[model samples]
Target: MQATEPDYKCGVEVTLEVIGGKWKGVILWHLKRKTLRFSQLRRRLPGVTQKMLTQQLRELERDGMVHREVFPEVPPRVEYSLTKTGWEVVPILELMCQWGTARLQGRQEEKEMAQAS
Candidate 1:
């Protein structure tokens, strides 16, 4: 019988396909907090190059996770914010963070034990 639900492996693969890049997660994290302009995003991520940030934002916007708004004005203002799909990723991001923290804590404890011995 065909399973009604998506295959777990394919599901994970698809999620990673859209967000596997180093900057994507960081970009998503910031967008989740509040809407911000392009310059604001650049300032928030100090190490990210302008080209890279621009590329990442374009990808996210294409994927429907991020919404880009452009205002016709003297300077042509633009802003970015998370869409409904993007907000859904928040809990997933939190889980990833929690897991990383736990892993780091476990590694530190193991290192301390090794040093003591």
Candidate 2:
């Protein structure tokens, strides 16, 4: 029997299901610039456990958003990069960064005004 696809309520829900997590978006953002090895990814993403990063990368790969290539060489170098679909998510992440910066600035201004009063 063929497997059924998930029934998403909307496009937003589908996007969230694929990239809604603390680390997934960040991972994609980091990979937007260039391909990175597993150790490089780990170093770039502080506070993420190796196990969790591995799991997240696996999920991204499975979802077709991330591409992982294994090189046949000493120590078996592995690298991760964003697929075309993954690159599409970059603009959304940029918007999120803008919104977050504005929100934080607004809050800081509010705090400064209150303190001055």
Candidate 3:
């Protein structure tokens, strides 16, 4: 279904507003499985600039979709994990993943058929 408003008239738009951005959904996908230290998340998404990742993470935390924990250690360790809402988003993300996989497979088959013809 198509989202009706930029003001988040429905659940889909609200979801997109919360997770919308180049990196937010990707970050959420990674965190869906486990809590990751900042460095670990950085390593996982090597292409993301540190500044951009920091921005996205801060936004997610503000929206309550992600939890940030700080450890009182000599070096000050920090970790990021999905909150309850974030975990609930997992099924939606999974459905998107499945849809993408199917689309890719269809494209591959179409390409092969075109080449054969």
Candidate 4:
């Protein structure tokens, strides 16, 4: 028998459920281009704490949105990249980013108008 998926009707809901955290979208955006080490991810996302980044990465891994690779080297390196499922979100994430920027700009304009009133 085939496994059943979650009861999400809309694709947006399902997508949101997978990447619906503060850091997940940013992490996914970075991973869309190329794989990155843990430290690299942290460096790119300056405001994210080490613990939060680790936790978010782990969650994404569990959700099958990201692939984590651990090397058995002397320094022990770990890298994260997007899975095929994760790659599907690239366009959606871009749209979200555009909408977010537009919303922020609109809010600023509204605030400025209010201040001038």
Instruction: Please identify model 3 stretches exceeding 4 Å from their true place.
Output: 1-6
On lDDT, the candidate that comes out on top is: 2
Best by TM-score: 2
On lDDT, the stronger of 3 and 4 is: 4
Q: Pull out the clashing pairs in model 1.
A: none
Task: Report the lDDT tens digits of candidate 3 across residue range 21-116.
Answer: 778988999999899998899999979999999999999999899999999998999999999989988888899889999999999999999999
What are the per-residue Cα lDDT tens digits for candidate 1 across 1-117? 884844557678889877778889888989888999999999999999999999999999988899999999989999999999999999989898899999999999999999999
TM-score of each: 0.82, 0.91, 0.89, 0.82
- How many backbone clashes can be found in candidate 4? 0
Instruction: For candidate 1, give the lDDT of residue 29.
Output: 89
Q: What is the C-alpha RMSD of each candidate to the true structure, in Å?
A: 5.6, 1.6, 5.2, 3.1
Relative to the unseen true structure, what is the C-alpha lDDT of residue 18 in candidate 3, on a scale of 0 to 100?
Answer: 90
lDDT of 1: 0.91
Error of 4 at 93 (Å): 0.3
- RMSD value for candidate 2: 1.6
Q: Model 2, range 4-116, lDDT digits (tens) per residue?
A: 99988899999998899999999998999899999999999999999999999999999999999999999899999999999989999999989999999999999999999
Worst lDDT run of 10 residues, candidate 4, spans: 8-17
lDDT of 3 at 25: 87
Scored by lDDT, model 3 comes in at 0.91
